[model samples]
Target: MKRTVITVDGNGMLSIPSNLQDLWMSEGELVDMLHVTAMKLHAVIRSIYKDGLLTVSEVQQKQETSNGIWQTLY
Candidate 1:
């Protein structure tokens, strides 16, 4: 986990730092995020905009790759 301090914009927008931005991308923009308090390390999380499990396109671009070792070469 990484952390950095950023300024909230006049209208209250939070900009993620450059490096962390690469990890969490959304809607062609980095998501506007908030942290909720939880007892456990991993909390039951939800996206700010969507109601439930996110759509592939809405969350990020989708690409498919196969593990080369999975094939039967014989």
Candidate 2:
């Protein structure tokens, strides 16, 4: 697992890191659908926040799991 920080711009936009973009691009034809990928990623992040799954213990448990993206935002 790896960790990195993301920043939201003054206009409230979050830029997906190039490393992540490259990884996703290698996953298949998603290179042509980067916008959709970003949207889905944002939605997943929003859902995690909305669902109150950001607790320390929960985040740790998720990081232990074998699949999916588990992120905690301050």
Candidate 3:
């Protein structure tokens, strides 16, 4: 997993680095390109919570069923 230190300002705003922003933009573009809907993503999150644990394989399976594009990100 990639980790980065993020600091929140006194106003409660997070200061995201440019690289992170670029990464997020690319992810967004990919999601759009793949036609992944918000509801599909939410369903994946709900399934994870219903399982009461975070498992990488389970998440990948759920994502595969929901969007079929998450594996590419990994």
Which 10 consecutive residues of model 2 have the lowest summed lDDT?
A: 22-31
**TM-score of every prediction relative to native:** 0.23, 0.28, 0.29
lDDT of 3 by residue, 1-74 (tens): 33233445666676666565322223333345446885675576568877887754433321232455553231
| Residue 13 miss distance in model 3 (angstroms) | 33
Comparing 2 and 3 on TM-score, the stronger one: 3
lDDT of 1 at 74: 5
Q: Between the candidate structures 1 and 2, which one is better when assessed by lDDT?
A: 2
Please name the candidate that would achieve the greatest TM-score relative to the true structure.
Answer: 3
Q: Which candidate order results from sorting by lDDT in descending order?
A: 3, 2, 1
lDDT of 1 by residue, 3-59 (tens): 233545777887657775435432212222333333221223334225556543554
**In candidate 2, what are the lDDT values of residues 1-74, reduced to their tens digit?**
45343445667676667574222222112323343574575576568868897743443322332466553322
- Local lDDT at 43 for model 2: 70
Candidate 2 regions off by >4 Å?
A: 1-36, 55-74
